[model samples]
Target: MSAFLRSRLLWPVVILIGLVALNVAFTDHFLRIQVKDGHLYGSLIDILRFGTPLILVSLGMTLVIATKGIDLSVGSIVAIAGALACVQISDLDDQNSVSGVLIAVGITLVLSLALGAWNGFLVAGVGIQPIIATLILMVSGRGLAQLIADGQIITINSSPYKLIGGGYWLTLPFSIFIVVALVALTAFLTRRLALGMFIEAVGGNAEASRLSGIRSRGVLIVVYTFCALCAGIAGLMISSNVSSADSNYAGLWIELDAILAVVIGGTSLAGGRFSISGTILGALIIQTLTTTIYSIGVPPETTLLFKALVVTIVCLLQSPAFRKRVARKRPRPPVTQTPVPVSDREPVTNR
Candidate 1:
């Protein structure tokens, strides 16, 4: 029980539950889920639906961070991917054609893979710092997206494309299924296939992992590539939800959110160990906080401040170093001795 309480994931879970309970306290029907048109409808479902993109991005960020690297370009990749797909779909003669939409998605993803490869090259092949390498793309990739968008938002009119984000399946949001599948796939690859050990080894110590017969450079490249791919998928979901791609704002500051989620999920930014389940919870917490802000009528301008405060609290509570420091500050109980009766005492006889 004590170990469980001390778990890194424990705080995030507690925070998430607290947020849910807070919402339930404020809104009478916050916990209620009703099915209409064969689809679930409720605040909970909405949270899951809206938080899907962040969860996906955070999942990829988890792997990247686990490899002792960061991908600051994910937000830009998201914008670039969405804009490219929207432009493709808009250009199709039959925008409603399923095949055309699929083609567009494929093209966008393929290009995203290429972009991921580019980041991988800069970091692994060129020996550039991960942040600096990804930052270069972070700055330039948005411009590339704007160019694809022709400096305007591109609205797509494809029903099949829309299904990726806003559709329902088995009476649940389809986006939830995507997240589940991706999470499962990631778990299988990392845990079942021992990929996680390699990642951890690389992140724990790259040079040592290399000397120990692991291909550090290849691992770094693969991790970055996978991270970008996740961002690409998130981009698709974000744009499809609204049926349009706003190149400038499609995924603004999402990288920061993703990093926060990853950190909140107990993945160290310094890189080594990571937790997928924790990340999902972190994403949920973030989404729930947003919902809570609106439900409680927090002014728009103060929302960020409110969120930062909550996040800071959570981080501090979860930090082992902080916990130790706090523990050190706590006063210790003084030890007291009782006087022994003369008849029963041996006295201070020295031999």
Candidate 2:
């Protein structure tokens, strides 16, 4: 029980649950869901639906960060992915055609895979710092997306494309299915197949891992590529949900959010062991925080500050160093010893 309480995951879970309960108590509709026209609609559904993108991106990030690398380019990749896909669809003879949608998605994902490999190459092969390397793309990717989109937002009403984000199936959001599948696939690959161990080994000590026969470069490439792929999917959902792609606004600052989720989910920034389950929870908590902020009627300008305050509190609570300092600051209970009465005192014996 003590070990379980001490686990990194415990605090995030507790914070999430506490926030949820508070929301549930304060908002009548927070947990309410209704089915209309065979489609589920409600706050719970929206949370699951809107939170899917974060879940996917953070899952990928868990791997990248676990390998002591960060991809700041994910948000730009998100914009690029959706922009390219929409551009292709708009130019098609039938924008709503499934074939056109499939082609657009496939092309966008292929490009995303290539971009991810580029990041990996710079970091692993060229030895550039991950932040600087990804930042190059992060800045350029938006411009590239704007160029592809002709410096305008691309809007389309393709039903097939809409299904990726706004559609419903099985009386719930279809996006939930995507989230579940990706989560399961990631867990299987990392946990069951032991990919996580290799990542941890690399992150914990890259030279040691290479000496132990682990191919660090290959792992870096795969993880970065995977991160890009996840960002691409998120891009698709974001653009599809709104039926438009805005190079300037689409996925702006999402990479920060994903990194925050990964950190809040119990993954260390220094890199080593990671927890996908914790990342998922972290993503959900972030979405919930957004909802709570809106529900609390905070001003739009103040929302970011409010959210940051909450996040800071949570992060400090989760930080081992912060916790140690707090523990040290707390005064210990004074050790109280009662003096025995003279009659009740035991006789002193000298050997």
Candidate 3:
């Protein structure tokens, strides 16, 4: 029990459960679930539904951050992906055809992979800093999305495409299955395949990893590509759910949220060790916080401020150094010993 309590996994789960309980206290029905047309429906289900995109983005960001890198371009990638897919679907006469959705998805994913590779090249091949490399796309990706979308919100009525985001399978949100599959696959690839160690080594010390025979460049390229891929899938989900692609607003500031989730999950930004389970918990926390804001009637202007405040407090709470300092005992002032003992002992020194 002690060991379990001390585990890094403990706190985040506790915090998430606490937040859920808090919501329950306020709403009184936060956990209640109902079945409608064989689909589970409730606040909990809604959280899972709405939180899926953020979860995917944050999960990808986890790998990048684990390599001591950050991808600021994920939001833009999201927009581009959704825009590209929607454009393809909108151009098709048989909007509801599964083939149209499949082609669009395939094309979008390939494009996303290429974009991710571009980031990898700039960083690994060109030796540019990861932040700088990703920033290039971060700034330009939105424009590319707009150019593809022609500065218009392209709406489609593709039922098959919408299923990716809004459909239910086995009475649960289909996105839940996607998130679970991705998470499981990531765990397998990282832990089972030993890629996690390579990533950790690279992040812990790139030169050391290179000298030790790990292909650092390959790792970087793979991670960055995977990150963009995750963002692309998220873009699809976003566009599909709404049946529209608004490039301008599709994934605005999602990178920040993803980073926030990664940080909250207790993953070190400096890179090294990471926790996928922790990241999932962090994403849930973020979604919960967002939900709590509106349920509690926070003003629109102050909502972001409130989120920042909460995040700061949680980060401080999670910081070992900060906690240690706060919990440390103050140094007792050096005790002043009277010199009288010397005089008192002088009589015994004759021997």
Candidate 4:
């Protein structure tokens, strides 16, 4: 039992199970399933639906963290993507058509790629710190988005656009399908190739990896690019959901949430290791926790406080010092002593 508990996979599994149990206990019919419009409906389905964007961002985040880097500009990129997409659609009268929507999505994708390249160049070529580099975008991307939208929220009345964020297929939200597809693709790429190992090696020791001819700079660039692309995808989903582009709130504070999800999933902030499955689980946990809070009628003002407390507890539990203290508190078996009557008598005679 002790050996099983100490296994690396045990904690994450336990955490996932515990969260599921908590949701079942606290929420009314947490996993209850129903049919609507010939589609499945349930709280679990809702959790996945809402969690898609976070899961996407965290997937990219896992890669960045594995390369010992961070991207704070994802939220901004999301804003930028939405803004660009809306601006493109605003110029067209038939914004509800397939062609217009495709054009907007394409434009957003291109812009996101360029923005990612800029971040990658700064971090990899100019030797800027990842946080500082991304922070610049985090601040400027919104401004850029606002500029594109002419400081107005561009309303989109497009079926295709709505489908991106709010549509359903086969009794499940399309966003959920997108997230699953991306997760599977990412898992395949990382697992089937040398990318995961290379990223981990670079994060573990950049100098050593470079010495071994791993092209660390190139890896960093790719990581940033991937992060930006994920942010772009998330932007599409969010903007589509509202059928409007509001740069101000499109993806506000999303980067922080992604970071939290990654950390909660047991991915080290300091880097060198990552877990895609764990990140997906972590995203679900966050969504479920949020739902649980709202279902119980917790005030909006106190939600942040509750989330903070949960994060604090999870972090503390993961701390090495806490683990060591727990280990020290465990009882040790006693040793028994044997009698030595003959030896005691011989020693007395010698004295």
Candidate 5:
């Protein structure tokens, strides 16, 4: 029981359950799921569906953070990705063609890889600080996306493209499947292979990892690239869902959310260790909170404040130091002197 309580994932799970309970308290059928046209429909399913993109982004962010590095360009990459893919699709003779969509997607992912590689090079090869290196793109990437989008939203009418985000298959959202597959693959690579160890080694201590013959630079490049790829896929989903790409607002501030999710998922921002499951839960928590905000009718002006307060409370709860401090302040059990039998007591001696 103590071990279970001490588990890093405990607080996150508790907070998630608390959020769900809060919803259940105020909203009827919050936990009810029913088959609608052979598709499952409910607030829970909606939370998972709508939160898919954030989950994917946060998943990638997990590895990058695990390496003690931050990628500020993910949101920009998302915007650029959607802008580029939509631009390509809009120019296609058959926008609905599966092959055309595939080509566009391939192009978008490849470009995203290159962008990730560039970030890796800046941080690893150029020896620039991770923040400044990624920030270069963070600040300028939207402008580049705007340029690709011609300073306007690019909308498309493509059924195949729509399937990437809004389509349902086997009575479930396709986005959920994408996230599942990616999460599985990431888990495999990190847990079942040496990749996870290398990332941890590098993040734990770069100099020591290098001394131990781990190529820190290469690992950095790979993680950043992978993170960009995730953002690119999320970009496709975001654009496909709306069938439009708005460069300015497509993925605005998503990086912040991804970072928050990572932190909330039991991953330290200082890096070294990470939990993908925690990240997923964190994303869900945020999504659930968003849903709760609407269901509970939080005033529009104070919604952000409310969200911030809840998140702050959760973070504090998750902090070991904070927990220890609180524990210290708790009143400990009173101590009572044990009564000894007269036979066991020594006789009093007085001089």
Candidate 6:
């Protein structure tokens, strides 16, 4: 039982189960699902809806962390993308026009890609620390967003744009669907192409990986680019949801949240390994914790404190020292031995 509990899969599974149990205990209708306007309605649905964007960002974060890197600019990239998209749409008479929306999306994508490449170049080519390189954008990305929006929120009245963030399909939020599909696609590509192994190798030892013919620089570039793209998608979802883009609020502090999710999901901050499934579970845990707080009528002012405590607890639990202490606290099984006469008889026979 101790061995089983210590398995890599154990903590994540336990946490997931604990969250589910908490929901069931706290909410009268935690798992109760109902059809409303041909769509599902329930707390479970809400969890997925709120969790999608975080999941997306954390997915990219997992990769970056795997390579012993961090992308602080992800949150800023999100703002930039949303700001650009909203600015483009703001020029149109009707924000709902398909052509205008497409153009905005294209522009956002391009800008995000470029920004990602810039970060990659600094980190990979110029050998800048990932944190410092991304910090440059983290500081300026919001300013750029404000500049694009002319220091004002850019409002749009477009259904297509709304659909990206707020629309529904099969009774579930479209954002949730997008997140699920992306997760599946990413998992497949990484696992099928053996990219996971390669990524792990790069993260585990860059110098060794390079000597072994792996293109570490190229890998970093791709990882940064992917992180930016994820941020871009998150921006689109968030901007679309409000029908307006506010650079200030679009993705403020999201980089922190993504990093937390990745860490809580069992990915090491020191890098070298990752778990997509674990990251997803970590996102869910965060969303659920938020929901739990709101549902229980916790004061808004205390929410931050609660979150801080939770994070601290999770981090401590992941520590080897804590695990060792816990192991020491467990009762040891009594040792057993063969009778002395039986042992002597066996020894004589052998001789």
Each candidate structure's TM-score, on Cα atoms with residue i matched to residue i, is 0.94, 0.93, 0.94, 0.91, 0.94, 0.90
**Which residue ranges in model 3 land beyond 4 Å of their true spot?**
331-351
lDDT of 2 by residue, 36-62 (tens): 999888887888899999998898899
Scored by lDDT, the top model is 5
Candidate 2 ranges with C-alpha deviation above 4 Å: 1-3, 328-351
Model 5 residue 245 CA deviation (Å) reads 0.5
Clashing pairs in 2: none
lDDT of 4: 0.85
- Give candidate 6 regions above 4 Å deviation: 1-6, 329-351
Model 1, 192-294: lDDT tens per residue?
A: 9978999999999999999999998888888888889999999999999999999999889999989999899999988888899999989999989999999
- Give the clash count for model 5: 0
Clashes of 6: 1
Model 5, 143-209: lDDT tens digits are 9999999999999999999999988999999999999999999999999999999999999999999
lDDT (CA) per prediction: 0.93, 0.92, 0.93, 0.85, 0.94, 0.86
Tell me the lDDT of candidate 3: 0.93
**Error of model 3, residue 171, in angstroms:** 0.6
Q: Distance (Å) between predicted and true CA of 205, model 1?
A: 0.3
lDDT of 3 by residue, 164-208 (tens): 898889999899999999999999999999799999999999999
Worst 10 residues of 1 by lDDT: 323-332
